[model samples]
Target: MREIIAETNRLQLCVPTMDDLDGLSALWSDAETMRYIGSGVPWTREQVQERIERAIGFCADKGMTFWTVVEESTDTIIGQGGLVPISFNGDEIELGYRLGKDHWGKGYATEIARASAAYGFDALNLDRLVAVCYEQNLPSRAVLKKVGFRKLGQSDVYYGVHALLHECLPYDLVR
Candidate 1:
């Protein structure tokens, strides 16, 4: 069963399932789409499978994970976004999102970021949320700023690569 966690005007964020493998594989396999992601390399189908499984486990154990983003009108899995434990630092939750290249520049990133922050602060009762993006990922940085994340400068703390770190509190949210 697909559990819908959050919704926007055109998208629904849902807990990932095995059924999302194909769509996720396609999204994560695109080099352009994976450019700003970890190691800046596309993921294999098997990697996608493992990630889906991890997402399921995270949902069951922590009540949150990177959720599958579905297009409301077409009912298509267009991306993934939500809250997840900071891999390198378990004490903090991170808000993140990724979208198919076709969905870029459509304001979906901001919507996803806003939804994720809301879920973290409201549903998960999180006091603080953090986000990091590649230094070159200006668009992602912009989205974070638009959603009320204060940039805390560059840090190599989360992912192995150096990234721009940002943090947000419930009261810091713009909307």
Candidate 2:
């Protein structure tokens, strides 16, 4: 599995290791971050471990995963973001992230979303990448838009809240 250490102007992106358990578990267990996910139910330690295992498995299976987002200077994991395998119209790589509440409203979401999409296209050689955000998640929708992802359509899941489906294609990059 490839541990892609992506460097932005102020952030460093890397996969979660064993040492990240405490931070990530805490982040996911927080009520705010889990609001849109599972109806604000705090995730259990076992669930967190399962998620970590799945992310690491993505690296082994597809050479990519939802990596931790850190401020390069402080080396603090402010969030998690990456392109992981998913299925929508068919097999696709999806963009996902969970930022700490303290790090919200800083455009970090858009910054990393764009970078993750770029990595999927440039490094993974994928023609198109997709993302799904809960209908109520305006911030996530905005991030997808800012990153140049177009809303192809929506889906009626999680009791008709409408998961907005978006895509980033190679042709879009040529613009």
Candidate 3:
């Protein structure tokens, strides 16, 4: 509801737009990316539109949603990193991110995650920030660890190799 926009050292974050459908569809269509997420069939264009609408609604309701992560120099939307809902985990909010294959290993995830976590804590005043990661997602786990989240332990998540639950608190901002 509050129109969240965050700027990090290398990227700018904003709400997902209808124009992002192509990128969202492309990103969600990847087998490697969705391997851990339980998308039975790749999302179509219409589905992407629906996703955008849903994201907007989420922002309207919760005051936040999956934000676009764009390069500061070129303004290219490399990927997205955001805080989204986890209904089963006590309706908890969790950090989520994905970049193109090219953007991997650049510390983009860490950079964006740190900002998102800070926004959640300081602006949103969330009690705890958490991320659910795939067991085999070493890169994602590494990013979460680097950004002040700790492995709270494992959870029986339906999607992924295995789900490792990570969390951080405002009082303990760094790991």
Candidate 4:
């Protein structure tokens, strides 16, 4: 059974499982949700399956991965967010979150983000966490900045879009 890693008044972050495939597919397959994420193209069902498999494997191997964020009141999966181990630029972890269109502007991202960062720093003992987004993705950039991320500079043009990297130490946000 997957453990519940974090919970807020309205959301719960838990490990992704096969049971989440449908919710995740609906969330990931929407073009609007896919915008600014790697490629702007929406993910196919097959790709969503593969992603679920990969997320499960990543959790087993790394003890960390993007988790399913569910709305507690409705028992509906509104999104996914968490800390992911990465090797980009160096050995480090990155924070990421994506929510369904219906859930946008609800502050769920920031709520789950705070819990994820606390888990990464206080529980996992990570030194820092990083986040990257397309330069034009103002909403995401704003969320990262609001969470205390400082712009490190531009990153490689990925998926035909210029990206920016931001980083924050656990203390930067937690304290």
Candidate 5:
């Protein structure tokens, strides 16, 4: 069963199930969409399955994970977004979002980031949330800024890549 954890005007963030493998695979396998993610390479179907399994584990153990993002109008899984322990097991939590090529530039990223931040702060009682994006990922950085994250400059502490780090507190959210 799919659990709806959060919602926006046009999207629903749900706990991912095995059924999401195909949708997630399609999203993660797109070379352009996979750019700036992890190794900056598209993930194979097996890798996508591993991600879904990890997400399920994270949700069960930590009460949060990068949720399966669904377009409410079509009920189609377009991407993933939500809070997760940095690197999947770090002490700090981070808000993250990703969308397929077809969904870019539609303000959906902002919606996901804002809703995820709200969920982290309000629902999860998180004192602060951090986010990281590739230096060249201008649109993602913009989304983080629009959501009220303060840039902490570059850091290689997470994801083994030098990412532009940003942090936000409950009161700093734009919601």
Candidate 6:
């Protein structure tokens, strides 16, 4: 097991491992869960394996990577999320998350996102964090807004689509 990264009342965030592939694949393969993500394509097992390899490498190199978000009480993995380094206009820390359909509307997204943002600011010492999502992803936009990310009036071509850009500072985080 990897070190625990964050915890909410009902969830725990920890470094992702190969063992997470089954749960992670199920989450990523769901069309509704991946609708706004890359290519809007449900990931295959091979793709998930590649992602796991990349995540492991990312953890090794950066000491931080996407975490497997799990329900503590049920010991079930409901999602994966984290702060990742990305090029939003040079180097920047980007907060990202994805949850299974069954986990939607449970406030788990907000809970994990808030925790992930805290780790970026408090643990990683990042002064600013950013996020990008499909313009139509209202739920994700709402989560970003709730976390104090402001719409930057900028758009970036990502995942073969234009995504709205958002930014937040350490002070902007909702404590």
Best by TM-score: 1
lDDT of 3 at 17: 80
Q: What are the RMSDs of all candidates, in order? A: 1.0, 2.8, 2.8, 1.8, 1.3, 1.4
Worst 10 residues of 6 by lDDT: 153-162
TM-score of each: 0.97, 0.88, 0.87, 0.93, 0.97, 0.94
Per-model lDDT? 0.92, 0.78, 0.77, 0.85, 0.93, 0.86
Residue 66 in model 4: lDDT: 92
lDDT score for candidate 4 against the true structure: 0.85
Model 2: pairs clashing at backbone N, Cα or C within 3 Å: none
Rank order (by lDDT, best first): 5, 1, 6, 4, 2, 3
* Per-residue lDDT value at 130 in model 3: 81
How high is the lDDT of residue 98 in model 2? 78
Q: Write the per-residue lDDT of candidate 2 for residues 1-175, one digit (tens) a residue.
A: 3244687777778877766778777788788788876456878878878888887788778878988788777777787898887643457777887798888998788778877777888888989887788878999988888778889888664234568878888766422
List the candidate numbers ranked by TM-score, top first.
1, 5, 6, 4, 2, 3
Our tally of clashes for model 6 stands at 0
Task: Estimate candidate 2's alpha-carbon lDDT, on a 0 to 1 scale.
Answer: 0.78
Per-residue lDDT for 1-175 in model 6, tens only? 6567788888899888889999888888888788888889899988988988988888788867778899998999898888878744567878899999998999988998899999888988889988898889999999999989999865654445678988999999985
Q: For model 5, where is the 10-residue window of minimal lDDT?
A: 83-92
Off by over 4 Å in 6: 87-89
lDDT of 1 by residue, 104-155 (tens): 9999989999998998898889999999999899999999999999999999
Is candidate 2 or 6 superior in TM-score? Answer: 6
Question: Model 2, stretches more than 4 Å misplaced?
Answer: 1-4, 87-89, 157-161, 173-175
CA shift of 20, model 2, Å: 0.6
